[model samples]
Target: MDGGRDSEIAMGAYQPGYLATRNRAARGQVHGFRVALWQEHLGRDAAAEAAGDLLQPSSLACVRRMNQVAEKHWAMFADDSFRGDLPGHLMAYPVGVGSGGELLNTRDKFPDTNAKVLGTKSNILPPILTT
Candidate 1:
């Protein structure tokens, strides 16, 4: 659901209610989710950097909240089907570029998001690459 870009970009790809980024309050939540993971797993400062965000960028507080939520979910999922068996705070990522979070065991091991060196910001789009 959240594999592609932001609000309008995400909405265009699916029917309504398909994903959390479906509404305005859910706006910036994708960044918040990533912030949560990075803050908990790495640290707050690192999370901010990966997000290209600042400590008081207005939504940074929301970022912290999302991190707390994910951490809490990990704790409360004692035997839940989604993430009970995972070793630590890490969430499961999808397999390859377009797998769309297939499943825990079915997909490949989650990649380290920290290691992703994304393409530079550009007005003209970069050359596309396929997996």
Candidate 2:
């Protein structure tokens, strides 16, 4: 994994006053693992072979494990049995920083070219004008 991608994942593992966002990250991790398994063990180009391999007992077990972990985390987020005091400070700090970091990282990867096109203009025209 790229250092930048890993850092973004780490930052996303938190949300203000709630751990639900971390659960979302966990789900993404499972998907990543599935993608790796598909690319490596079954080969990305071999769709038929991948399907066959996924039917095997070992593959089934791996799928089951991933599903179980995802279910557990999802339940934590969905459940609202308790109505105790919220962790305001804990929620505010981590969620904001983590979300901001993610936004910065994403923007770094794909910059807004509108600024370059518009130049010093206070109001720029639509993309259609440039095309």
Candidate 3:
């Protein structure tokens, strides 16, 4: 939201390609797919290092590394470079999408009958302070 300010802008590159699930295998937001995939690449000793950066956006490292692993049951892969071939500028934001939705168990998980609560009668924030 800081559109304008004569100051240095800092960006953290933690990364973001991990498949999303309601389930958690590690700490907050760590993907199980990423954990196992990384585990295979690293030895007994610094395997944790591979698990560290699963969230880097459009992370080719995650995709490529996952495909290399022998176990395919937990892995889902198709692209060789996994969008690595795309230009760097193109990879910034909104360049891609998500994992395969298991079209079977999926119903309208957010049923329209009950999801209207977000815009319900009183979801208000305290008014912003002014200078």
Q: Which candidate gets the maximum lDDT versus the true structure?
A: 1
Instruction: State each candidate's clash count.
Output: 0, 2, 5
Compared with the true structure, what per-residue lDDT tens digits does model 1 show for residues 2-64? Answer: 444332122222334424433333335554554465566544544555454432334666567
**Please, what is the TM-score per model?**
0.22, 0.22, 0.21
| lDDT, candidates in the order shown | 0.42, 0.36, 0.35
Which runs of model 2 end up more than 4 angstroms from their true locations?
A: 7-58, 82-131
Can you tell me which runs of candidate 3 are displaced by over 4 Å?
1-46, 71-131
Give RMSD to native, each candidate. 15.4, 19.5, 17.7
| lDDT of model number 2 | 0.36
Error of 2 at 50 (Å): 24
Better of 1 and 2 by lDDT: 1
Native-referenced Cα lDDT, model 3 = 0.35
**Which pairs of residues collide in candidate 3?**
15-55, 15-56, 16-55, 16-56, 16-57
User: Predictions ranked by lDDT, top down?
Assistant: 1, 2, 3
lDDT of 3 by residue, 1-131 (tens): 26344332444323355434555323333444545544554433334543544444246875654443323311222223343322111111111233664223222222325332122243464323110
Clash tally for model 1: 0
The TM-score, computed over Cα atoms with residue i paired to residue i, of candidate 1 is 0.22
Q: How far is candidate 1 from the true structure (C-alpha RMSD, Å)?
A: 15.4
For model 2, how does the per-residue alpha-carbon lDDT over 58-95 read when each residue is reduced to its tens digit? Answer: 46765664444444433333345634432111111111
